[model samples]
Target chain A: MNVEQVRSAVLKLSVHNDAVLSEQGPHCPGSETLDIRHFGGEESIVRPAVTDMHFPEVVFPTSRVGRVAGLEKVRELVVEHHRLIWHSPLQPIFGGNEKHFWKAVELTADFHAEVCGGPKLYSERKGHPHLRERHFPFTIREKDRELWLDLYVQALRNVAFPLEVAEEYWRWVESLSIRMINRRTTFAEPVRVPFNHIAERLA
Target chain B: MNVEQVRSAVLKLSVHNDAVLSEQGPHCPGSETLDIRHFGGEESIVRPAVTDMHFPEVVFPTSRVGRVAGLEKVRELVVEHHRLIWHSPLQPIFGGNEKHFWKAVELTADFHAEVCGGPKLYSERKGHPHLRERHFPFTIREKDRELWLDLYVQALRNVAFPLEVAEEYWRWVESLSIRMINRRTTFAEPVRVPFNHIAERLA
Candidate 1:
């Protein structure tokens, strides 16, 4: 086969759901076997994978809010948080016109609300929330993530978010924010502030 | 002044060529004084700077080529290097349709040629090349950068780039590639491959 045809075939097989691609060859060492299944009930096709790099996953805090009032509370908290951050000193990080900024805020609110057990507004409108890809345009450093979290804490306190679910929510945002950091300024890992440390502020 | 007015004023001052802004107040600790000047000959406006973060700069290998056939040789090497990478296993890193890929390649070639002592093609067509911001859409890791350099070395040998100029070119790309890495897979700093180590390969 020509190089183009070979690449096309490999790409087709790699994307197939029932394709079981193994990279345990000379190309990549110590790579895991990927058992990708295609929706089509086609026979499994095995191929030597190119690169097995995986993008970071964003796990939303839906279950935590589901235990409480769920969607309504999530919407309230997310909207208030976005508002607080929009007004905060971190506003420059948005780096776009006012219209773009508000549009981003709306989309973000929809995504957060949907993820945290609200209606499927974000999914229905924007399909999948590729949060990392969406955030790639902005240069988010470790300090920026910290600043974001700080504003979020302030928003939670200002909105009087329920202290019962505050810890889980904080944990979710804290971890997820780390994934948004596209720029590294220091060799040290990002700082982690546990829920107990900010419990009194939320109360 | 209102927040928007203050922001606009700050942005104006920050972008000014002669405005000396200080972030040494309670806001940012140990921040250096920024002597930014405005081209409009307006009086310097000193203000409490917002964030003191600086984007990484891309220093091209213009001087090294000036010592040889200058722009012509740089263009030849850059074009061949790009062609090699486009055909390499790293093709997926471009992540677009064939038309988009070719456009990116052309734009990149223009930018590289302009930066490496060629004509003002990129700047005339596209404004400032915010390299990091432009590359934000791609999930470039340390491994990807290494793979890029590997393909680059092969390109250099294939094109038979001058030995004298090759070292500087390699150094330029090696350091510049690190800045392109937005995703951090390891806390350790990115690997550095000295030119001498790959001297045999280039020969």
Candidate 2:
């Protein structure tokens, strides 16, 4: 197992743990660990017994491939991505508008997960996930999509899934999200200010 | 999950990805997402059909649980935790480390998963996981563990697992890894440093 795969196993264990709520996999160090007596003696080496994270492989759905793409992976990404966007040293500057920034983060995170191979609630449960239908509600202008895509690309890079995988995935997502823009109505209305694309920013 | 579980998952996924080599498990999106196509062309939103990353869950022996602990909450933590860690910038760094670090990350990840309640590799195969025995082959010093744990804990915080759970999990992990340090027979021992306890690093 690669590091990510083992991580995937640990995550899957948590999925199995849905009801019980412990993480009896690697990094845990086990319960015998709870018994401090093993440590006090001379040269005594103790390996703690895992209390409860492992489980039947039956617990997980069969489609998640690699260390990178599971529902569990998505949830983990969602939480972390949100934390970075909403809680970082720079995020507070958004101040009273923090919710908007987070909403955008959530939006991008969902879109990014789909790109990286995570589950999709908005798209799946609902249908076509009309990015426009959903995002149409936002004041998403071209600048917004560009900015959104910018943060999104960063998140994708931050996640660092395999390059080809990410390329194949984001190539579609970045383009597809364009479907969500209100197009004629939003863009034609004219007040939307534009910003540089990712390439431009880098240049 | 509470951050302890998140930390565990990240620890596991961020490391150990290269260990077993073959890709296994965690397949399929929810059934609701199967086989649909992009609808509006420009607005193309489709069902969550299978991506390459998606895999069906693989079944493993229940006996594997003996190695790891924390059986109480495996369902949610396993896949979920890895999801977050897999995305972290640290993942690439860990993947790039030497074999020793690679193995250490895998073992510790196994340790975390077991502690929080997932699998059991340590006990099933190695009996006690004699940390010193397993580690003596390498030049592991206290500083090594400290640096390792630092990166580990940083990954956890970056993922934003709840602080209390994070701290508890960290304490347990930190407490355990300390035992892995074997005296250096070939080099002068670095001065023992004060504990860099991470009790206060919370979001």
Candidate 3:
């Protein structure tokens, strides 16, 4: 699927109706499901059709993340992600300022690098990373989150992120992105996009 | 009508089920409602039975809040609020360290004073007051928020906060408390306690 198709699918999947899920189960019956194959010959599994309301705690696969890609590549991915966001419809969400945009890219690079076990760059420069609080000034609805994930997918593809740890990295971002949503525009909870569904698209 | 009774009532009111409300309406039919009289001889209104999922932005009544009570009283209220939290079941959530507890009280006092239009003490000392982000480490569930509002109610009553701005102040804290909930322990949204319900009890 193309970026637009992927975006549409992600949005449809993430905002799965709670009423339907409750009557059915965690995996929505008859809803679209993607077969995700695990790396290293593990069993392939079907992506759950619905997401729980719980905002999960992301435990970064620091070792694998750092081993697969160095700091430079990580920085490149961060820059690419920002570039995608800047060029997308969500540009206004970042306040439409070039200086602020680049500054955000720099800070985000530092944060991503630190989270991936590169170095203590973010904390040393900016103190504790209270990310949710920092993003409070912006109004991030559920749709914005889907757009964000779409852009990130493009970034990962653009940078040719190693598939060895791509799923792990995808899981991190997928869960972490939910926490950034400060505003609620819908009764539906944010959707979850398993890496398998995007893996083929990225390839 | 004592603090304990008030706490129980607030807890019961705030956790009003969503299924029940949806079947009924915004104001839960047959649910207990409280009569709240306005300060300036306006009509007394009944408290709504349920709270929406939206986390409201607190607009401080700077003029009235500052006029009715000065910086000293605001500080006292902040300190008293923290004192109550420390003495209550929620004390452990503050890390059980006396030094950290007092430091939080000081910072909070600065924030409260500034928000009440006293001075920019908090922003001067600490860069910005990201209340939600700062509380990220704490597991602030819906019930925790209820307890917090309970204590704040007690603090307001104990300090004899001027009824002139009591409703305004209550609305601010009541809504602001929802923003601090980082964890979701239940499917139910946080309950809202209208000032009228507690006003009679406080009096």
User: Evaluated with lDDT, which candidate comes out highest?
Assistant: 3
Docking class of 1: incorrect
Better of 2 and 3 by TM-score: 3
Superposed Cα deviation of residue A139, candidate 1 (Å): 1.0
Candidate 3 lDDT tens digits, A97-147: 799689878988987776666677776776544445355445466779999
DockQ of each: 0.03, 0.03, 0.02
| Better DockQ candidate (1, 2) | 2
The window of 10 residues in a row where model 3 chain A has the poorest summed lDDT is: A35-44
Two-way DockQ contest, 1 vs 3, winner: 1
Off by over 4 Å in 3: A1-53, B1-203
CAPRI-wise, candidate 3 is: incorrect
Structural RMSD, model 2? 22.8
Mind giving the per-residue lDDT tens digits that candidate 1 earns over B1-203? 53323433554444222112212122122112312221011222122212112222323454435446466666666777778777765666665477877776777777665555556777666554434434544556567788888888887788777888787567667766765676643323567888998999977
Segments in model 2 whose C-alpha atoms lie over 4 Å from true places: A1-203, B1-108, B184-197
Question: What does candidate 1's lDDT look like per residue over A1-203, in tens digits?
Answer: 53323433454444222112112112122112322221011222222212112222223354445446465666677777777777765666665367877777777777666555556677676553334434544456667788888888988888777888777567667766765676643323568877888888877
**Share of native interface contacts recovered by each model:** 0.03, 0.01, 0.00
Best-to-worst lDDT order: 3, 1, 2
Question: What's the ranking of the predictions by DockQ, best on top?
Answer: 2, 1, 3
Q: DockQ for model 1?
A: 0.03
